[model samples]
Target: MNRAAHLLLFAALALPLAACSKVTADNYSRLKPGMAYEDVRGILGKPDKCSDLLAARSCTWGDDKSYISVTFVGDQAVLFQSENIR
Candidate 1:
């Protein structure tokens, strides 16, 4: 592989890891009531899991021991919380 190809591959792999690292207390604190879903998504990257029932939606990032969760009702953030995040 050429030098440029190696750099491109490295960047592609590193980008997702960088995104995963965004799950922190500071970022969780950045979430607020009335924020749009896309806004939260931008701050937290893609959620690990999500579910919807009617106009309410719930999304969580990370896993059992540490996680961030946001509850949205009708496209606006209604509540959010985190556990064991640093």
Candidate 2:
């Protein structure tokens, strides 16, 4: 295949993989304070784990390479953190 064709094919395949990725810097960057839970889910997909606290709902998503945790009060995200990014 030509170089341009190879690059195009690679991007086509990689884009889907990127979309399926768990919470990482790329996806985590999309999150913002006060974003709705459903909007966050649309960006990062479902959390690997989640729980409810007295004041908020906590959710996490990550793999061995990286992790992100978010706290939501009512339906809005109040805070989030990312760690161990590679």
Candidate 3:
């Protein structure tokens, strides 16, 4: 009975781990630095803020907590940075 209880407890603990999300559309961790703004926009949807990234040629997306800064040199995001406040 005790062994069965321990097995049940281990399975319960592992359940959440097994339930962890697989890579999908909403998973932003898969995003890369050089992806175009339009491509990224399609994946992330509208952003919280839009402004200059580095200079007038670049653009960025950010919020109060986190930010994804993208610099455009021609037709793509040539430079990118992500920052977290806290």
State which candidate has the highest TM-score.
1
Stretches off by above 4 angstroms in model 1 are 1-20
> Which 10-residue span in candidate 2 carries the lowest summed lDDT?
18-27
Q: Compare candidates 1 and 3 on lDDT and give the better one.
A: 1
The true-versus-predicted C-alpha distance at residue 44 of model 1, in Å, is: 0.2
How far in Å is the alpha carbon of 61 misplaced in model 2?
0.3
Report RMSD for candidate 2: 5.8
Expressed as tens digits, the lDDT of each residue in 1-86 for candidate 3 is 69999999999999998655322333356567677777867765555556563543554455544666556655566666566622
* TM-score for each predicted model, relative to the true structure: 0.77, 0.69, 0.46
Clash count, one per candidate: 0, 0, 0
Q: Report per-prediction Cα RMSD to one decimal.
A: 3.5, 5.8, 9.6
Query: In candidate 2, what are the lDDT values of residues 1-25, reduced to their tens digit?
Result: 9999999999999998877666667
lDDT head-to-head 1 vs 2, winner: 1
What is the C-alpha lDDT profile of model 1 across 27-80, one tens digit per residue? 988999999999999999899999999999999999888999999999999988
Residue 72 error, candidate 1, Å: 0.5
**Candidate 3 Cα outliers beyond 4 Å, as residue runs:** 1-28, 52-56
Looking at model 3, report the run of 10 residues with the lowest lDDT sum: 19-28
lDDT of 1: 0.92
